[model samples]
Target: MIDTERQDWARGWSKLKGFVEREGHARVPYEHKEGAFPLGQWVAEQRRAYGAGQMNGRRAARLEKLGMAWSAADARFQENLAAARVYYQEHWTLCAPRSAGALDKPVGQWLSNLRRPGALDGHPEWEAALEAIDEDWNPSWPAEWQRHYAVVREILAEESILAYVEPGVTVHGMDIGKWLARQRQSEVWAALADGQRERLEAVGVVPHVQALEEPAGAEEPAEPSTAPVSAFDRGVAAPGAVQGPARAL
Candidate 1:
């Protein structure tokens, strides 16, 4: 009976070592099997034993050497966080919708779920890890809106004249010109939050508020009228020389 138990443990450890070498982590899926060996089940049993305080110190230390993660959920979070980091490096933003993915992970949907109210409760470390990649991994405004802002910022970094960016123009697959047109609308400009407006202004994207000429003998200032002015007519000077119309309060 003692010899049989030692052989069983040796077989399971061999299979687990091979699994770790191939996958680079000891996070085998629950139903995974290595040929005829139930490696996944064996790994789960060890975790159960560890939880029950029945696992031996030497055995647990050996498992840890192979990068074993006792808490499966913590292992999953680390994997997803790695994917998020990869996505951020490529796109410079984490405002991906449900359809986005990274490193074979459903990172977009994961981030979307995490952005829900109180979703990170008791998970401050997870929040910190994400913020380290991009501070606005979650924003007060819509994530999609933040995505647009990030892409446009990239375009501006190239010294592109955004005002002249016509409709249908795209940056990073986003229709920034169409988006800018919407932001220039009086109603849309009025609807934007103060912080959003300020960010736009800092980037020389203030709305083109052309003022109508004062009537004959009028004492009051010219009434401001917003128009779909051509880019040339929008006072789109080179960066430091940008002079935009006064925005409505």
Candidate 2:
């Protein structure tokens, strides 16, 4: 009786294994069909659609059901998009125009080419040079400026000098020149380290202010408009405006 029960169990297990094998084979053709669903390809398509602002609620839901989380994918797409923008801003000048009246080739293509395997196969030193260029490039000047500005304010505070102008006189503005003059006149300036003075100069808060006074017999220069000049308007190169590694290409 025991032998018969053991044989019955073996037969059942064998049948189950055969069923699973047959089902797997049957699913192969559908899964591997010319235009069937492959996870990587499907995810890529969804990402492209999302990046182009075409992924609607229904499509997003469908993708979620296929094990692709929309949030994670969208975040990655946004990050790549921002990086692409920076790459373009930094390297636009490096790209030669493809034709007359034509814009330079998109930076995306250059990035793709650079990222490909064997991209520097014949010239390994190019890779090292590019890395060095990247190390030297800074793309976060706004933050740097903010920190420097804070330090300048702190130094002024220690001297009890207001760095900003009277509210109605200049519409809540910073008088960089006045602040610099005060610093120069105060003992704090002499006590500051050389690096601190250098930092102040680097931020363009020097004691030198271009005289707006009109020359003798010349009309008073239109009263010198009160409108403020942004850093960009003053010809300051913004973050991502630095030369990039692509210049070597």
Candidate 3:
């Protein structure tokens, strides 16, 4: 069942967002709040933050300033947040159609998508980093994982997330999720001719390699140990094992 809350929020956002474009404005309801953001203030703030010259630091500072200015009255912020959430969702749909149901995928399924043939065949280093990304960032996605995966793969393989142009890095507007998704897929790696594959693998996405090499003192990967355990064997007279719940006390 679709979550009613999300449905309502999305519907409300669609209505409100119509007034958020370059030449759009929605008047605040008098009863809603007297201190709501005025159109002019909102535009100026957006201009400062979204302008070509703004960096993350400056953009964040501006946002914090705006947040502080609106701190005294939170209704406006809440409204904007709700609207923003919907806006982000819509943008994802357009830019990353594969993430249609990203909020609902099972973690395992999403992880497994990383292993599909030709998906992450190339860029082994990037693939490993993505597979090893902090669990906190692992999406607790749902069945729509495919859609998000498609979006991510596209961005990583084509658009890239780095905003600055450099010899070994691609700069684009794609987000982490999309970029990671690309790492899982075999875009660059899969497309290589056999002769080029080994060379690419040895090179292995220069940016990712540099990142992994940053910890100069990190230990080399240890040889894996092999251990065996059996549920039945462990259940029988194992030291400190429970003895039938202490024989029912």
Candidate 4:
């Protein structure tokens, strides 16, 4: 049994859809059609035509009601968009780094873990932070961060350990370089060949270890400089060098 309100809404919606289709405009949600029509003016025109006897009162009322429905839908859509913008602004840091396609699966799993009961007890900020990220939007991180993310993602993907790259598990403080270095030295890193290690070090993923040994049969490293060390060099004294009142004694 079709209620009168449902019947009326269907009739009006059909007309609107037909009009949009006939005009060659792609059918889209009411919110997406904001610029497609001047809905208020169209409703006014229908009312004016009805007053002039160009259309009967029933048809005019139906069209007018349809226009109002579209207006309401559009208003709600706009409110949602504004709210999303605020969410992104507040949580951009968290969302941007995990925006890559490779990170999507782990990110989803991470969010699901966070939403579990009592998971966020002591960390209330995480509730808001996780809510701000929309998996559908896939908001991109800054250009610099994106580059770093890509490098780390590639390394993880190649190693078949993408799970380790999940938020908070690794990448704490967003320090991908440090994380990569630590991972490189882990037991898992033994699976990688020398070439892979060298490649990672080349890109600064792993810190370059200064070779302390002289080349085979080559002279020893130069003697430590006698010039006064800058404040920055205080603790990094030269090997075999003495300092302080011990030298005076």
Task: Choose 2 or 3, whichever is better by TM-score.
Answer: 2
Q: Write the per-residue lDDT of candidate 4 for residues 1-249, one digit (tens) a residue.
A: 759955744554565656565654322322232345543234334444555677655665665543333233334333333334443444342333333222123442343344456866865433443444443232222234333444464554455332233223323245553444454455645655564455444443442234466568867676765977432134223443222321100
Q: Ten residues in a row with the worst lDDT in model 2?
A: 25-34
Which residue pairs in candidate 2 have backbone atoms (N, alpha carbon, C) closer than 3 angstroms, thus clashing?
none
Identify the superior model by lDDT, candidate 1 or candidate 4: 1
Q: Give per-residue CA lDDT, model 1, range 93-137, as digits (tens).
A: 999878889879999999999999998898787788788888888
Best candidate according to TM-score: 1
Residue-level lDDT tens digits of model 3 in 141-211: 33243243333334434533322212222212334333332433456446544533432233223222222
Candidate 2 lDDT (Cα, 0 to 1): 0.40
Query: Pick by lDDT: which candidate is best?
Result: 1
Clashes of 4: 0
With a 3 Å backbone cut-off (N, CA, C), the pairs that clash in candidate 4 are none
Compared with the true structure, the alpha-carbon lDDT of candidate 1 equals 0.76
Lowest summed lDDT across 10 adjacent residues in model 3 is found at 162-171
* lDDT, candidates in the order shown: 0.76, 0.40, 0.36, 0.42
- The segments of candidate 1 whose C-alpha lies over 4 angstroms from its true place after superposition are 1-56, 59-69, 217-249
RMSD of each: 10.5, 21.8, 21.5, 16.7
Residue-wise lDDT of candidate 2 within 139-199, one digit each (tens)? 2232223333453444444533332321121211344333445545447566655665675
